[model samples]
Target: MSTHRPLRIVFAGTPEFAADHLAALLNSDHEVVAVYTQPDRKAGRGKKLQPSAVKQLALEHAIAVEQPEKLNTALAQQQLAEYRPDVMVVVAYGLLLPEPILTTPKYGCINVHGSLLPRWRGAAPIQRSIWAGDEASGVAVMQMEKGLDTGPVLHVERCAIDAQETSASLYKKLAQLGPRALVTTLDDIESYRERAEVQNHDAATYAKKLSKDEGKIDWSDATQLERNVRAFNPWPFAWFELPGGKPGQRTVKVHQASVSQTDHRSAPGTIIDCSPAGITVACSQGALTLHSLQLPGKKPLPVSDLLNGYATTFAIGVNLTNVD
Candidate 1:
């Protein structure tokens, strides 16, 4: 337990992951003097200016919030300086804090990262874990420096990545787990004598930011489970282009799938069958069954339901021609 007066902590983060940590802090003994999040940006189909989850939550809590375009700007730095926070807690803040801002707070800025450092040290750690087929990954709360996730780890929390876990599911788990570890880190911070260890650069692996364009499905070169299912879950979903039959070439996005290593007879991307349960496709090493999918102007539905409405069979030997 912290023996010192409840420290006035400044928080910097954006997105839902950061929002979870901010919510946790609100319930703690520490005082959050200010919150810093990215500016509202165009979102959704209409591209309306929507505030970040953190910003919205902060407003509800009645906490002072700042949405600066750049931390390097003198006005932004001046605003942060005025807070005079003992420590800054940063969790997925999106923008990089400049050198002046990094050391502005008394204890410097601490980041709650979503990976076991020095393993994943970049953006999109959760998505990278699933894409890399990692069995388990966790969160690390570290003392931030200028580099990206290059800070020394102070506390870590591990969680298993089930074969069925997707980015959305794993993110939820990490969001909850991160707060527990953050509280623990703050308790340690109160002691004020612990040394922040440097990360092993040789062991570091970078997780590059994911873009919509990276979500394209390549059935010919990828496993049915990897491309047809796991890799395409939330954004930039894995999809295939069906040849022009009636209107034109339509794109179908596959969302949920299961892999089986028992069968390896059928060629990859060969639609074994499509039923109410899902669409089963053959892979090079095994088989995959897709349970959920989406087509143009359609919501996600079971492969079987999709067949009933469209009456189109993803029959065997139908090659899902790659567009890109």
Candidate 2:
């Protein structure tokens, strides 16, 4: 939409979320000179090397693709120079763009970050937002800089967070919202860039990456357990380890849960009830109704479906509180 000449953009990103934006750019009028994505890596049980979603989409468009392990390297920087890009678009690129690469293009680099500036600035912003029980979360398009997600914001788009919204749901929402905002910001690039708002560093909070260990449900707080059940879904799902199982230990993944107020004096982790509704596990303050779950190497299923097969799994009075 800029009145200036059409831009030669260098697109850098890796994940499916990033690919969505690149897909939109390809449909736009601008020319994407090159695509930069992480090299294919092993995935799934078979561990076959998998190209990133962005790479797959780029190849389909017949765009040039580069998978440089290190963009800070002189060779990588020079290769970027050869393209003579007017600007670069980066989203969930994983690899950090050193200052040299950030400042290379005439219009500099633009980033579509998951959360609003000065909040959840680091990795795992979407998951952090859900874990924090935030009422709302959104995307921010910023002019890239050396610091992590600290660049000034050129445009922002916000949406309410549903009470039951999980990391997966919020991620998809932001992915769709980001590209639209990015396109609008680019319509009048220089004007928006010149008026970009500098972030308030003092108010910043880092969204530390989610970890499998953290997915171990802590039943001390029923509310937190419910949130974790939502926050950790689709990856490192909220799980617990029972001390005595077929193998002396078994890990159970909690896919869907809700905080319950059922009166129960039993200690935390006790299976207070297992009905068609769910398996209610007593917590410190209240109880958690686990609606859906999955055993190792098994598909997720509702409690009703699971009860038909493993009725013994949620036997009343059995302690389900072990964290691993």
- What's each prediction's TM-score? 0.89, 0.95
Report the C-alpha displacement of residue 320, candidate 2, in angstroms: 1.4
Q: What's the distance in Å from true for residue 310, model 2?
A: 2.8
Q: In lDDT terms, how accurate is model 1?
A: 0.79
Please report, as a residue range, the 10-residue window in candidate 2 with the lowest summed lDDT: 241-250
Off by over 4 Å in 2: 1-5, 246-249, 322-324
Top TM-score hit: 2
Q: Write the per-residue lDDT of candidate 1 for residues 85-141, one digit (tens) a residue.
A: 989999989898899998898889899888889887898788888888888889998
Give me the candidate number with maximum lDDT. 2
Which lDDT value does model 1 have at 53? 94
lDDT of 2 by residue, 90-208 (tens): 99888989988988999999999999878999989999999999999999999988888888999999999999999999998998899998877776788888889999999998999
lDDT of each: 0.79, 0.89
Where does candidate 1 clash, by residue pair? none
